[model samples]
Target: MGIATVNPATGETLKIFEPLSAEEIEVKLALGEATFKQYRKISLEQRSQWLKAAADILERDQRKFGEIMTLEMGKPIKSAIAEVNKCALVCRYYADHAADFLKDVPVTTDGSRSFIRYQPMGIILAVMPWNYPFWQVFRFAAPALMAGNVGILKHASNVPQSALAIEAILTEAGFPAGAFQTLLIGASQVESIMKDDRVKAATLTGSEPAGASLAATAGKQIKKTVLELGGSDPFIVLESADIEAAATTAVTARLLNNGQSCIAAKRFILVESVADRFEQLLVEKFQALKVGDPMLEDTDIGPLATPSMLLEISQQVQETVTKGGKILTGGQVISDRPGNFYPPTILTDIPVDSPGYSDEFFGPVALLFRVKDIDEAIELANSTIFGLGASGWTNDPAQQERLIEEIEAGCVFINGMVKSDPRLPFGGIKRSGYGRELSIQGMQEFLNVKTVWIK
Candidate 1:
């Protein structure tokens, strides 16, 4: 299949490219392996300088890069620019911190003097998604390259231009030709690429099925894999929470990235006392949101990345409605205009077996649940198979402690929205996928933790 960029807003094909042939793939693989040998010997200071330069480029041409992302993936223009800026921040973060993060750790072992040395493994394969394209890749590449490992990106086919732009950014920043390359190939080609001996490990940020396939393939080779997959994160509001604040945040929390984000709050569990007021506030806020072209600065929500995404979320909402759920706001696709525009939606009185209660709704849709107390809220929040990220709003110190301790997620935000930060470790648990990304833990994911002993 040809790799192409089809505008989600207009359903028009803007650009297309041929997938790499077997011969081309072989050459890139060989080049990556060869580059790793020499790149690994380069000093930390040099790598840091190159990474800093990459950050500079990102900041200098952020609007250009931001437009590429908005056109390819349909994220709002303002958010797209923010994503590029975040990518630059991560580059600078790793550039300044990788040396300390990877420094030898002196250990008190039996050998006269023992220490743990962190070293690059080799060429790493990154299977990334179209959503947050720049942010995701840079978060992986900055540390991977800083630790001396090279990267070969097999980005989502629909975002080919975005993918190529990333390689150009790194190359312009002075990274070696093979130090970071973008593979313009289809998903069918990933298996063969991963099987190659030159590719040492892999990292993926996408769906659960994709993550499972990569992990299984790498498991056979005994090569490592890190996955950041789907999430149906919970947003809990108890009786003590400031209802006004929680509802305002709930709008943005549920609809960020047009609701394509894995960590965007999908399920909202509220105590019965505040449920009515919170639901009213949510409906007003959702209705106030503007749905239009992603390229517009004032647009609050945009099209789903693809038509299939629109169909899937529509079906999910219909299923919930069929199973006794009530639609408090939007429930239909905006068909008068072109593109995959979906209005912000809310579903309440959801049945136990409905998609609203169990499945992840990857669009501008929110599922609301009411519970009698915090006990029921916590129990309902942990019901899903995904334990990625969760947000809890409460002022009572007792409830705050309980929420922090009881939520079955990798990270829980009290009185705030769930988000990923460069300074903190980010990932999920259970079906949300294994391993971590961002911070010190992320940089170490593909490194070899070798033990050194001195006589």
Candidate 2:
């Protein structure tokens, strides 16, 4: 099947695109290789200038770009706008910091002048997801481009328009022709791209299966790969937490991006002393969210990005309930809605052995588990196979310190919500995938760390 954009809110096909033929794929790959040969020779100052221009274009056309994202992926209008702005921020960040980050470092090598130099690899294949269409691609593109690596994007099939728009943005920003290209192809086409000799390394921000497939392919080719895969992040609330604040933040954390984010809090582990009150507040908070048309400014939650997502989430919730879980609030899919809308669901007493305990619910559903103490909280939080991000709510300094030290995640937010920032390195440990993104570390991911030794 070719790429198609169906408005998730209305279940209408807004646009469709035919996949490129084998000839077209070869032509683009040749162009990308040709572009990288010249593009990598450009000065850092020149690349920075283009990146800054891209940021300017994003800020200037945020409204238009945001609408495209919303129309294609069913994100709320406000969130889509914010996503565009965030992409701009990342562009600006890499533009400003890339030179410093890639600077050569002198090393003490046996009384001679030796240094390590960071240089770009060849064309990189970026297999990106559609949950945060614009943000995800830009996060990869900004850093890779700044590192002097050309990119070939294989964006999720559902967001073809966003994928094309990104290529346009790069061209408008004065990037050399073929510096960045979008491949409108399906998952089946990725292996061929990976096998291309010009494609040096690959990075993926998607599901576990996708990550595994790409890693396996790249592994056989001996090409380096970075995988940012799925997460079932935990939100732990201690007895010392500011209950009101924790309760409010928990709702937003679990439901951001309509709960499609891999780092979005999926499991809630509340200390038993405060479990009763916290659960009460959580129910109240989730029940008050306004779910409707994503185009509306006031909408707090929107439909799942696709019908499959809705069905999967619904099945997970139903399975959890059947396995002795309790639904405290909304559970059924919304009625009289043309879109893939499921009610904000809260499940308590989910058995630790149930599938919901390990699965990342890629929608607005939160599982609650009452813990006896801080030790139990941490145990429950770390029980998942994914370790992308975690949040702990507590007022005690010692408790906060302990949780931060022990939480097995790429990021830990104490008494606050977890989020990815352009300034901070964002990536997960364990099954959540490896390598950092968006900071000085992110800029170095696609670079060649050449070590020079003087005789």
Candidate 2 matches the true fold with a TM-score of 0.98
lDDT of 1 by residue, 44-144 (tens): 99999999999999999999999999898899999999999999999999999998999999999778999999999999999999988899999999999
Pairs with backbone N, CA or C atoms under 3 Å apart (clashes), candidate 2 = none
Q: 150-244 in candidate 2: lDDT tens per residue? A: 99999999999999999999999999978999999999999988988889999999999999999999999999998899998889988888999
The Cα local distance difference test for each model comes to: 0.94, 0.91
Question: For this target, which candidate reaches the highest TM-score against the unseen true structure?
Answer: 1
Shift in Å, residue 31, candidate 1: 0.5
Deviation from native of the Cα of residue 164 in model 1, angstroms = 0.3
Candidate 1 similarity to native, TM-score: 0.99
Winner by lDDT: 1
Evaluate candidate 1 by giving its C-alpha RMSD to the native, one decimal.
Answer: 0.8
Q: Judged by lDDT against the true structure, how good is candidate 1?
A: 0.94
Residue 253, model 1: Cα distance from true site in angstroms: 0.9
